[model samples]
Target: MDRITLAFWSLVIGLCGATAFFVTGIYGQQATQQQREAKLESGDLVQLVKVIDGDTVVVSKEGQPNATVRLLGIKTLESKHGKDEVAVYGRAAEEALKRLVGDKPLRVLLNTPPRDRHGRTIATLYAGDQDIGLGLISQGHALVYSVYPFASMPVYLQAQTTARANNLGLWGDPEVSAKAEAMINEWARQGS
Candidate 1:
């Protein structure tokens, strides 16, 4: 083949390969979205074994391993830490979560990225008629944490506002306390 013709064909092949890669990427993203929706609609039922804290809960399912769920869109006080000191409102958040979902039938709505690095199921949970995460925020036991994909952002934000205005839970402190926020930031900075 002529030199020019060979170069032209090479360019065409490269373009085709690039196009294929782009199309595959787009399709993969769409498939991921669809899978997340399907999981949410499936309403996976689980039995709450215990409330680890306001934002974390342990649940048991038949034929499946026990999973730790991190309540989506919310950050509650550090109630049960292995090394760190318990932050303000930590005990209250723990008690509130226990009252909401401990030893109850709960439904887990998995997020797009299901399990977090800590092996906790990142999901929006429903216990009976209450949205567990929203309940904690609305009652002033937790704060809206928007770092990840949360089920209902607007509702959770409103709940946080109400809680703050009412001076409930962590909001009651005399001044803005950076304890929990600092701890979370440090954890993230350390890539933990």
Candidate 2:
């Protein structure tokens, strides 16, 4: 075969390989989305395995596999999210959450889409009707995370207000609390 023909065929093969890779990636994303939706629809109660951070936890329920649950309507200081940024009261917030919600099967309440962009459950957790997010906010470990659409925004905001009023947990640390308040304000603005 001519060199020119050989080169053309090689280029065609490369294009085909690239297209296949792109197509596969798209399907993988779709399958992930479908899996998340199915999990949310299941409504299986999950036992808390451990806390990943202040606002995230690992849980497992019957029938379904273990999954990471991101606590809704609250954003706590980042404790272990790499070296880019770290907050002062991050560990304290995690410890407080562990204490507040010991060992229990948290009923996952799907408020909106089953998962966030990162593929984690975006839902409210309840320990026998008690909202977990409210408990965390009341202790001042987390601020009302109103940057996104959520049903518990008003209640979470109220809990945060009460925490601030009495100077509970992180609220006692003025510097940290001030930074958190600034973040909360920004989240509220974006949400609006």
Candidate 3:
């Protein structure tokens, strides 16, 4: 074969190999994304294994390991390692979540990208028709997590406004509200 023809064929083969690599990579990424979406489909029923706090819980899906789920669009006071007033409100939040969830199976709805920086799955859990995250905000046990963008942000904010207006739960107590506000600001600062 002529040197020119041999060089042309070699170049064509290299280009074909590169194209195949890129195409495979794109398809592989799509497959991975699809798997993630399918892993926690909306309306998947899960048992509430434990309430970590007002905004977090341990849940068990059928045939899957227990997962730590952080409620989307809400932040609860620290239930551990805080002063008396903060801890008081924090525990109140936990109890409120427990009461809301009871022993019922939760309908899990995941947020885009699903996982948080801490590797916990970020989800909005529902007990029947009630959104557990919104319920906490409505009861003033949680603050609307405005730091992160989520689909329920607007509704969560509205619930929090009503809770504040009614002086329900944490908002009813001036001391707790002040402490929670300070903590939330600090959290925002850390996140930024």
Candidate 4:
């Protein structure tokens, strides 16, 4: 190759590497800084504050108040923002999550290693023996995240199959059935 051509290719490769580092903080890897945060120590008990949506929650542990927790292994429909109307099945999904975690008094715990780019704790939540994200998927309120494997993957996949077979929640609603997974893939594709 000519010297000029080689130099140009080198510059382009360097620029792409630099951009990926600053943008996603890792090359060809998806977990953000937040998701890369230190894993919660085993046996730490964190209390649920409230459900943020179908898959996120506000929680606290001892001194840390209102820590954001993202449910591992699943993603739900986007909830309404500001004065905007609820996305199709959004409210129902959120409500379903709330019912699953209602006043029976529940606590959240993380079996995952890190948080998301938003600095939200990535976690697996259970109310007694029930897995929260799996419950959402089974009810058709959520889907397997697919970005990374979680501890309960097989069961979550089974739940998703059952939910799909039954046409529950988002899967059941033709209005969003096509767009829902696309939005999720787009969001992940953009790494936001």
Q: List the candidate numbers ranked by lDDT, top first.
A: 3, 2, 1, 4
The TM-score, computed over Cα atoms with residue i paired to residue i, of candidate 4 is 0.68
Between prediction 2 and prediction 4, which has the larger lDDT?
A: 2
Better of 2 and 3 by lDDT: 3
lDDT of model 4 at position 24: 71
Off by over 4 Å in 1: 1-42, 81-88, 176-192
Better of 3 and 4 by lDDT: 3
Cα lDDT of model 3 by residue, 45-156, tens digit: 9989988888989888888667778999888888896777878788989999999999999999988888876667889999999999999999999998777777888898
Distance from true location, Cα of 59 in model 2, Å: 0.9
Q: TM-score each candidate.
A: 0.66, 0.76, 0.74, 0.68
Prediction-by-prediction clash tally:
0, 0, 0, 3
- Per-residue CA lDDT of model 1 for 1-192, tens digit only, reads 999999999999999999999999987886564444322223888887777777887776665656767888888777555534345477788888888876678887887777676545688888887899889888878877765534598788787777777877677774433564564466456543
In model 2, the runs with Cα more than 4 Å from the true position are: 1-38, 81-88
Q: What is the lDDT of residue 28 in candidate 1?
A: 86
Compared with the true structure, what per-residue lDDT tens digits does model 4 show for residues 12-95? 999999887787755324444334433454455666677888888876566644567788888887777543333656677788
> Highest lDDT, which number?
3
Badly placed stretches (over 4 Å) of model 3 are 1-39, 183-192
Q: Point to the candidate with the largest TM-score.
A: 2
lDDT of 1: 0.73
